[model samples]
Target: MDEHESGAAASGASGRLARYVVAATLVRSADGGAVVAIVLLAHASGQPDWASGLLGASITAPHLLGPFIARRLDTARDGRKIIAASALIHGTFLGVAGLMLPVTWAVVPALLLILSGMFGPMLTGGVSSRLPSIVGRSQKSQRRAQSWDVASYGISGTLGPAAVAWIAATSSPLVATLALATAAIAGAGAVLALPRQSPLHDPGTVPSPAHTLGSIWRFGPLRRTLGLTVIVAFSVAVLPIYAVAVAPSLGDAALAGTLVAGYGVGSLTGSAVLMAWPLRGDSDKLTSVLAAVVAAALLLVIATPNFTTALLAFGAAGIANSLFFAATLAARSEYAPLETRGQVFIWVGALKIAAGSAGTAVAGTLISGASWLPVAIVAALSAAAATVCLIQRSKGRT
Candidate 1:
């Protein structure tokens, strides 16, 4: 085939892969929501808070391992196989977990950890690998594609939580889990249908995953982007806690659930906005400014007494989140080589998970003893510090 014809064929395949990737990601989010409901059920069944926290940790802990595995397996040819396998494994585990429900708290967490470990890398690797094929050699197209991916994530995130709420309210948590398992199984099937060929690879040079990660880290823009991403993750971590703290003011615990759902909705809207107008300027600077906005919005969330005001504040925070995510992903894709994109993306995922965990734990503890305002203030300060660091790093890069 001629170059144009070859490019057209590759683009067609990449578009199909991107759709499947988005579907897979949505299914993964569904699984995550089911896991969250399971943890909540465990707590309701008289499990200790610490035990529930452990279960939550189990769901997230595999993020630490995913990058390491991606580093080893994220090559041009084999990465798709790894992704497909991971999806199968994830579906299998989810099925097993569903069958074993109501067995013990310990078993639930163990299964969740195994499922997460397998699924995490697959999700990140699949998306990152497709970037080159979708965007080709155009820098502008790459940025737009990154925004599109973030928009997909935001949509999935909103739907997942809503699905959890619906399932948990009308039926049982087990039923919710079963739905999640079904989604996972469907996603695995979709992955199996993806085109086997990838366009990101150069036949002459195959870079090691570690080298790819190192290159991404060494890039001035990416490094700054990571810093800002940490802030975004940290701020997001505090959100659930903020919902809990504001629950009393809103009149009930159920309102807390609504608040969280509202945040997701806001995020979905924000992502749509970004997709419509993808970030184009220096991503490093844009990320910092978004971080500052997130900080301000978070503080507004905590300070507001009424539900109406709180919803608006949280919505603004969600906008900040969408902006930050789009810019960071765009910048990271620009800075990282295609061969090692999976590894680079996975490392960023790891950092986001770690920062989020720390932020949630710290925010939860602080809110228990001190006022919510203090937690908000601290979170804002942390965001501000991250923003300053990002700005300084960007200046250094220039």
Candidate 2:
């Protein structure tokens, strides 16, 4: 290629990356804000705790049918347009919910909340499935893009809650809810600004859902990676317990918050570092190695008597968490059938949510009987088992 053409290509790639980052950040930030806002709004309106749970359910319940929604996107001529439209509608519903929650009948607000949540699967699944197309097919480029995507989640997770708390405290929870609703609409505008692209597949020949799902089951690598992902998700469910566990040991309770926050900071830092130093060898191997390292860290958290030692270990585990996600995502992109790519992404996401829920439940039971150490031990053992399975599977594949 000519030097001028190469320069133009680089510029275009950078521009696209910037645009995608902005759009992703907006959507994720809104998600973070909405979670806190929903609960706060329910409480401020004199609704019961169950009402807050209902609000959360309205959002998460959509993931059960996420694969179908993702399938619809794969078959659409312009998934980007679908994403923009959904974001707009979602924002409208949230706006109505915000308005109704403060004054109108509770039923109306509840319905509006449910309606708003119906579009979440489309927004998240569409964005993730489209990353390959947006970033191009190069492995190194894909790794960087996926890392950035994970980093975006961490950033939004941090900022979103803070924004909600600040806004609700200074203003009103309803105002905070409405503000996040506006952020959703802004996210739609950002989606609209994304460069146009061809559909994921020919709409005429888009694989049936059954075929796509069957294909996922048949692909050994995809199957195992997904299984491992669920295990990882389950293992991380008790991460919040770490803060409680660390407080007594440290003699300074505030150190517990710092230790917990270190995980996110480490994840963000790891995303950047992994972007530059891409993992070598098989992606599954990378995943297994990461899982093992994370397992070791969790064990340290369980065994360490010193606060500093446990804190550093927690940070290392956090970095592994991010790296494992990047590796697994890259593996999915590489191995998933083109016709079923969207389904795979949606399925993985749903599975992670379910697995995390299960993990949390199990940890709660264990912690009630004993303490945080038992929960950490359970999580670590689960991860170690997954690592062993991956290593054995890799060996068999060889």
Backbone clashes for every candidate come to 0, 0
Every candidate's CA RMSD:
3.9, 2.5
C-alpha-based local distance difference test score of model 1 = 0.67
The TM-scores of all predictions, comma-separated, are: 0.84, 0.91
Candidate 1, residues 151-207, lDDT tens digits: the string is 667766666656866887798766766676667667766666655546344633546
**lDDT, candidate 2, 144-197, per-residue tens:** 788787777777777777788899999999888888888888989998888766
Q: After superposition, how far is residue 146 of candidate 1 from its true place, in Å?
A: 2.4
Which candidate has the highest lDDT of all?
2
Q: How does model 2 score by TM-score?
A: 0.91
- CA displacement after TM-score superposition, residue 365 of candidate 1 (Å): 0.8
Worst lDDT 10-window in candidate 1: 197-206
Best by TM-score: 2
- All candidates' lDDT scores? 0.67, 0.74
Query: What local lDDT does model 1 show for residue 387?
Result: 62
Q: What TM-score should be assigned to candidate 1?
A: 0.84
